[model samples]
Target: MIELENLSYTYGGGELLSDVSLRLQPGSFHFLTGPSGAGKTTILKLCYGALLPTTGRLSVFKQDIARLDRDQLALMRRRIGVVHQDCQFLDHMTLAENVALPLTVSGQIDTAQREDLSELLSWVGLGTRLDSHPPELSGGERQRAALARAVILSPDVVLADEPTGNVDWEMSQRLLRLLVELNKMGKTVLIATHDMSLIRAAKSQVQARVLRISQRQVQLAGADL
Candidate 1:
């Protein structure tokens, strides 16, 4: 659903990404691995239309990203859910309200769809925490809450960065299971993480492809993992 051709991004006289080219097929799951400053997150931004490339081309869902205007980009983004490394939440708002923000902003909220909202929170293991504020949540709780919010719109694709970074092993596994479930439901999933152990754990449970960003270049990881 996403393709990049000879894409590059430069900032402050240094190249963050260079000649990166790849195609993410619909219904595929990918894990992006890289050291700090290797440009994994930058690449993610390009895919989601958050940052335009300094050079070359990027296409999302068949639309040329470079040519899309603000409204067009917003429309494309609505079809893709993104979970950031930091769970960006309004500390004053309840968890349910946070998860419902996408719908609210899109003018797509359905008051009659209360059951659906509750079911999503429950799916991410956050049902009881729905009334709680962001500050009250544990690290894992916050991550899951973020995931719940991302998928509440039933997006066609999900892009997650360091999704299990702060969670314990068990909680990480739980979060991974939820992501796996989403993949089973046919969502294209791309995750950026530094955790090799998490990638290994995921291998046995799903058909996930691994991509490593090293030396400013992107390549498919080997079976040597």
Candidate 2:
């Protein structure tokens, strides 16, 4: 559903990424692994149309992102859910509100689907914390809440950057399970993480291809783990 053709991005005499090309097919799951400053996050941003490439083309859901206007890009993103390494939430809103913000922003609200939101929160183990503020929750709880929010709109593709960066091993595994389940249900999943152990854990549960950002490009990662 996402394709990058000879994509390259440069800034202030530095090349964050170059000659990167890949295709993320529908229902495919991928783990992006790289060291710090290796452009893992940059790639995720490109996939979701956050930053336009300095050269080459990026297509999502068959639309060329390079030619889209701001409004068009915003509409395009509605089909792709993104989870950042640092969760973004309104400090004043309750966890439930935060999770439902996507629906609000999309100008979509079905009173009958209120139960769907509750069920999502419950799936992420945040049902009891629905009324809790962002600051009141633990790091893992916040991460799970972010995941719930990203998928609330039922995006066709999901992109997560460092999703388990702050969670414990058990929590990481739990989060992985949720992601795998999403893939099973036919959503495309792409995650950028530096944690090899987490990759290994996921490899055991699902058929996930690994991609690595190296030498200023993204390529299919070799079986090094």
Candidate 3:
């Protein structure tokens, strides 16, 4: 779980986020929406310990992020999976190797884990693409593969930033369903996106709290959403 208390983040002498408070509970689903440059990505970074609050407090799993040392922060990050907006991958690595990077880095990769890796890729509809490289994948394939990579470690929380930004409506819905499935499995989910239609589509399938960023603050969206 992640909690932010009266948090503010300043960059380049400007305050991008101010007085934002949020608590991500276990098994919860949330959608963060706002226009471009609204600090949606900034908030996700704070939640996963990628960036510390410039003022106020941020805690991941009950420990203040500002107080954690490097090693501790690294260990804490393993509990939070993130799907970046860019869907970055090593061009030289195979899909299976890319998805298994987390396990490899954490010293958890082995024969049994490789079998599980195949299952994970299969879950993302990439079972047959394991031998392919990043350049060989289509847009939707890359997004789904990114999701697979993010959850490969079985993180307690999953944060995705504009996950469907590059895909078509059908593929977007597919990714949404995959995320919904993860929520059903009891993983905490927070997705930052500008797509209102996607958020609307998710509401019927799952109970999701829509949080909108406006004027440097975060507030729960009303029924209009």
Candidate 4:
């Protein structure tokens, strides 16, 4: 679980986020919704320890982020998965290799894991693209492939930014279903998206708390999504 208490961030001589506090409990599902440039992604970064808060405190699994060393931070990240708006993969590598990058980095990639890699890709509907390079995939395919990569490690927390931004409605629902399934399996999930329809759909199927970022602050979504 992740907790942020009175978190504030400043950039370029201006405040981007202020007095933000929230807690993500175990097996909780959260949707972070905000307009463009409202710091939705910044909150995600803070949740996963990508950026240290300029003020206030952030703790991951009960450990204060400011107190963790580099190695400790790395170890903490192994329990969290992040999917960015723009998926980045080495053009030289196949889709499977890109999805398995986390395992390789954590030194958990072995022969059996390699087999699980295939099953994971199939779950994301990318089985046929395992050997395909990044440039060869369509936008939706790339997004699905990114989702596969994010959860392949079976991290306790999944932080996604605009995960369905590029996909059509059908594909969006497909991706959402996978996420809901993960939450049911006891993984804490947090997704940052601007699409209210997506948030509404998720609310119908899962007990997801919608948080809206507005006026440089974060709060539970009110009469919005």
Candidate 5:
């Protein structure tokens, strides 16, 4: 549902990404891998309209990002969920309130949504931690809570950046399985990570396309991965 054609992003007089083209189809799963500073996060930002391309075209759900107005862009973003590398939560809010922020902002919070919120937290294994504050959560718990919040709207696409970076292997696998389950439910999934083992582990359970960024270009990773 997201496509980038010959896209390039420049920052501070240098190009971070150059002539990159990729499409995320419905129900597709993709892993974006590269060295640090290779613009993996930039690609994710471009996909979700957080940053516009310096050159070329980016379309989300068939609408050109450059042509969209501020309100239109805001509306379009609701259909795409993002799990940032740093899972930031309001320290003053309860986990439930934090996860339910989107619904509250959209004026969609109600009894049924509250029920769904509980189920979502439970799905992320945070059902019993509803009243806990962000500072009380561990790294893995924070990541899972972030995922729960990202998908709380049941968005059509989910983009995650280094989601398992701070967790242990077991917790990483747990997060991977949660993401895999989301893919099975037909949500488009794109993850940018440096963890090769995690990508290898996902191969058996999901058909994933691994894309590598090298020398300012995007290429499909070789079988060695």
Candidate 6:
């Protein structure tokens, strides 16, 4: 669960977000949409504590993000999984290794976990890409791989940035299923995307609240959720 109250963020001496307030509850699903350079990514950053708000308050799991020390922030992050827009990965590492990187870095990975990881990669349709590097993957493959990495730890909250941006319609539907399944299992999920069709498709499958970012404020997108 994450909460932001009257949140504002300033970048390069200009305000990117202003007077935004939203709360993500447990087992809730949300989609954040906005035009280019409209601070969608900035809001996601604030959610994950990547950037602190220049004004107002943000709390992650009830702990004031601004008050958390480095260790506290690290611990909180482990509970919140994020799939970045760029689908960032270590190009030098194989795709499977990249997907498994989270647990590996957390010192929680083992042979048993690797078995489950293989299943996860397979679930994301990346079983064959295990030995391939990030640079060798197609756009859709990279997106799925990033998603696998994001949820490998089964975090309490999942934040996906432009999750369906690179994938085709069918693949996008598949990815949406994965996120929906996670939400069904009681994990809070937030996604930032510009895909209105995707949001429209999601309307019937789940009770997702579509939140649109317009004019630097967060407003519940009308009727489309």
Tell how far residue 215 is off in model 3, in angstroms.
0.4
What lDDT does the true structure give each of the candidates? 0.91, 0.90, 0.93, 0.90, 0.93, 0.89
Error (Å) of candidate 1 at residue 191 is 0.7
Tell me the spans in candidate 6 whose CA falls farther than 4 Å from its real position: none
Stretches of candidate 2 off by over 4 Å are: 223-225
lDDT of 1 by residue, 1-225 (tens): 899999999999999889999999989899999998899889888989989999998989889999999999998998999998888999999988899989988998877766777888999888787789999999999999999989988899999999998899999999999998999999999999999999999988899999999889899999633
Model 6 residue 127 CA deviation in Å: 1.9
Task: Give TM-scores for every candidate, taking all chains together and pairing residue i with residue i.
Answer: 0.97, 0.96, 0.97, 0.96, 0.97, 0.96
What local lDDT does model 4 show for residue 162? 95
What are the per-residue Cα lDDT tens digits for candidate 5 across 159-203?
999999999999999999999999999999999999999999998
Tens-digit per-residue lDDT, 136-210, candidate 2 = 998899889999998998999999999999999999999999999989989999999999999999877889999
Estimate the lDDT of model 3.
0.93
> In candidate 4, what residue range of length 10 has the lowest lDDT sum?
216-225
Can you write out model 6's per-residue Cα lDDT over 110-218, one digit (the tens) per residue? 7776667778999888876788999998888888898889888889999999998887999889889889988998899999999989888888788899999999899
Tens digit per residue, CA lDDT, model 4, 51-170 = 899999999999999899989999899899888778888899999899999999999888776668888999988877789999999888888898889888889998889989988999
Q: Rank the candidates by lDDT, best first.
A: 3, 5, 1, 2, 4, 6
At residue 93, candidate 4 shows an lDDT of: 95
The TM-score, computed over Cα atoms with residue i paired to residue i, of candidate 4 is 0.96
Cα lDDT for residue 62, candidate 3: 94
For lDDT, candidate 3 versus 4, the one ahead is 3
Q: Give the TM-score of candidate 1.
A: 0.97
